[model samples]
Target: MTFEMLFVFGLLAVTIALFISDRLRMDLVALMVVAVLAVSGIISPTQAVSGFGDPVIIMIAALFVVGEALFRTGVAATAGNWLLRVGDGSETRLLLFLLPVVALLSAFMSSTGAVALLIPVVLSMARKSGLQASRLLMPLAFAALIGGMLTLIGTPPNIIVSGQLRAAGFEAFGFFDFTAIGAVILFLGVLYLVFIARFLLPQSAIRETGNPHPTLSVFTERYPTAKQLHKLIIQPGSPLNGQTLSEAAVRSQYELTVFAVQRQGQFLSTLQPVLSQTRMQALDTLILYGRDEDVHNFCQALQLRRLGFPETEMMKLQQRFGLAEILLPPDSPLTNHTLKEGRFRENYNLSVIGVRRQGLALDTRFIDTRLAAGDTLLLAGAWEYIRALESKRELVVLETPAELQEIPVHAGKAHMALSIMLAMLMSMTLGWLPNLSAILLAALAMILTGCVTLSEAYRSLNATSLVLIAGMLPLALAMESSGALSFVVDYLIREYGNLSPILLCAGLFLMTSVLSQFISNTATTVLVAPVALMTAQTLGLNPEPFMMSVAIAASTAFATPIASPVNTLVLAPGNYRFADFAKVGIPLQILALAVTLALVPWLFPF
Candidate 1:
């Protein structure tokens, strides 16, 4: 190796040392590597910074938005819930369903996206099932890696290897060509993780899923609204059926607040907001909050039938409406006036459900009780209206229920989000659009269609992962440009060429897998694929087995968290140490190698 090559190798050594030490952040180390290469004249500044704009970085970032949309729209939660029901509290059963499903999804989409979408899901599942996150997360990352081996578009390395074959005047790999070995690997991988790996994983302190903020039950108990809130169905010929909420003025007539209306349709029912011009129809169920006597009097006078407002129905209503604790400022104009006297519902469109004075919840009628400057009011309204209260200078939003975060803003638009995601998936699978283009369109569609808001999309990105991936890409470029990669590959093949072809394949697999642990697997494949092809040709053997081995080995990036983005994504959530991966991953790596060695030659014999 020349001086520059030696220098590049030294820089790489330091970088790896930093990564393994965990003393500095991974992204910072990657940035330092880029800066060193540029300062050392190893690479031009333009090339050094090009990684930030690489298609890989852009694609991963876009995938974050799509994953976030899936999350915010409840798609991931829906899948997680289904898996939970199928698993039925069995860890092995959960793994049986989880591993293959994630792998299959990874086969069709970006592995990073698949992992990102499911990390939260898996965490939620683990929390619910009483399993260690570490036990389940590493397997998730590994299965996603295996998933890339399932389809041509599953990962970049697969596509690169196929293109390499096509360029060599051989038929390109069919879409499902990788699926044969991949399915076997997935099956064996599931068995390994379920039986062996679980014993090896750390029993980390579980991240609590329970929110600290007060729940709906807490609000209901404090306000004593369970017995007070009632649902009334408007009967035929009721005078209130054809009148709008503004015209009916139930609050004015009976002192009961019409919080919302549940309208039943032929196929489905909808929760309608009680707006000024919202006209009630016959058979409409009205969600009301007031004293029992007042509610009974209103129902009796209006010829309405009272229905039991069960806790489950209240929870469902909580999704459409929000509950918040508001404190009246001392200088507030409405501080001395009662809720009804202040026209609270008409002026603010929020009904005061309960009042707490000096830390004591009032047991008496709060609507007619004069409000105090320091009194706390429990308000209920649509989420939008509840959110609007935050801007008022006269009142302080002391607390909002934690359930609001769990509620999807686009819950009603779940089907639309699902359709968009399916369309994106189909476009990618059928090659109707390029992967990056399809991802961008899908992310944009999510925002445009309000499946996820712009702020939510922005919050979805993992800055560390994006920076880490972008930063390391340049190091790969430097390795390829500086001849370090070729120098090592050449030396290895030159020394080992006279050996048996099987041994040669083994060596190639080992080299590719080790290199993939530190650099981009796509770069690893680009460099080693040619060597594999040339070695087979030199030995007068068919190149298919060697080429296939190289591709398979490139995906065995399980030995390090930095080996693949999938691995990196799970590093923190799994609370894994460097040795944790080596302990479990090294064995899995060896297993994959054994499987590839035993199968590739048999499947594509010379």
Candidate 2:
């Protein structure tokens, strides 16, 4: 290899390392790669930023806006409610309903968007039904992935490959061109998950599915010391503001123990004397602990009737558990403190249900893992105890039905967003419009119709993905430009040139599949698409089959969370070990490869 080749190769390796390390945002990594290429003279400055103007990049950005509109309007959430109602509390019923629900949603919506909308509902149902969360979450994630494969706009990789194919002078894929093969794979994939994988799937995967409605009577019977009580949030300017527990004379006057105080979003543990130094503030939430008689007395004394306590009518004996969310702050004392060290249960008297960090839900083992800033913890305990902890600064409560209901939704905007997306897909598939123009128009429509505000739309775009696609596009171009792709193609053909096209396609498929498991699928596709094109050129065969194989292989990330965002989203929620993917995914990967190899040639006819 020439020195230039080695330098280019080294730069590519470093860029990939940084991307996977996630020490920097992906967009930054992409820009850095472009900078390195320019600085090293491998590509020009103009070329470095050229991908920003690429049509594929533009389309992705627009689609992001469209997706945000769906989310903003709660259409996705509304659709998910159906599945939530069906799953209610049965694991078997949930799996049966969720698989198809997620699949249908993913076929049109973004996988990440679809999964995000469903996760909360799934958790809620799991709690109600007393089912394991692990059993349902993986299926939810897998279904999204499988569904994405069925349509042109299902996932980014499919669109990227289609653009690359068009750029290489072949026809772009229609909205449903790959549906036949993708549908079969989707069916088989869902079946494998429902029947076989569930058995092999780990029990820990379902750890967060706690019973939402635990019978307090049963709990009192078992642990008679456990008291049932109401926790009150003292809104700012409330009657209780600016009063100390001692000065307020809660115990003497109201006959209630001031178990905890949440003032200014910080929880003060009355168990420690130092806590007495802190004064009450506006918006302080008080966790008053006492027997049922004292709770009534405390409420009467404070003139605070209607504490919104879960009553017998609202509380199913099976469905009366409390839910609280806590976020680990950067300077929290709990940071780096394990559950054992933090005396979590002893200190708070709550069971940690789940954790969310950086938009991913974490497993129960997270208690053993050191808490970090930005980590959100979902905990289950008595209503009083949870309210007390909610006052602490270390944890942020994410679920407040009133707050959720307050989020703005533009119902009409959802229809416009949906229309724009359809138009883009139709224009691109029918050859009447360039993919770039169609996408750009769609993005404009979203903004114009107020489906997504301009600022929100811009914020939703995955800048890293765009940068990565743009930055890598040149390097991929350079390989073809420099005859490097042909060199690789020459080497492969010489070694396996005499092999049947089917075997050659199989080899290419396997290579792309393995590469995707380690690197970004877009990166894998950009790097391999050129070689597939060159290999087909060298073999004097149609390139369509080769390209189709690469597209399928790149998107089928079955083995690792790091392999795809969808996988990462489920990591904490499902409590999946890295090996979990291998167990379920390895077989799926084989099945996908088998299906792709069998169908691609027959459909595209290389």
Total clashing pairs in model 2:
20
Q: Measured by TM-score, how close is model 1 to the native structure?
A: 0.82
Best candidate according to TM-score: 1
Give the per-residue lDDT digits (tens) of candidate 2, residues 1-606: 666666665765676667546576555666777777667676677876777786655655666676666656545444444555665555666687788778776777567556654665565455435567777777788788888788887777788778988998888999898788889888888888888888778875344254333332333332222344456666545455666565675544554444444455442321211033345666555554455666666655654443554433223211223445666777877778765477565567665545566867553235357777777665544444655765766566554322222122465465666677677656755657765676677778878888778888877765544565566666654544445544554566578756787888887788778767755677677777777777888889988888888888876888865566666556666767656777788888899999998889889998
lDDT of 1 by residue, 1-606 (tens): 788799879988998888788898887887887788778788898889888999878877777787778777767666766787888879899999999999999999878778977887787666546677888899999999999999888888888878988998887888888888888888898899889998788876745465456666678777775347778999999989889765776766677778788886621125866765678999988887888788778878888999876544554576578788889888987888977677777777777778888888886456568898999888877887887887888889888876666666677778888898889889888899998898889889999999889999999888878787888888888888899999999999999889887898899999999999989898899899999988888789988888888888888889888788888888777877666787888888888888888888888887
**Runs in model 1 lying further than 4 Å from the true structure:** 68-98, 116-140, 169-172, 191-258, 266-269, 275-281, 287-319, 334-337, 357-360, 364-369, 406-420, 444-460, 494-504, 569-584
lDDT of each: 0.82, 0.64
Q: How many residue pairs clash in each candidate?
A: 0, 20
Query: Candidate 2: TM-score?
Result: 0.53
Per-prediction TM-score = 0.82, 0.53
Model 2 stretches with alpha carbons more than 4 Å out: 16-31, 51-57, 89-145, 148-177, 192-406, 409-487, 514-548, 557-587, 598-606
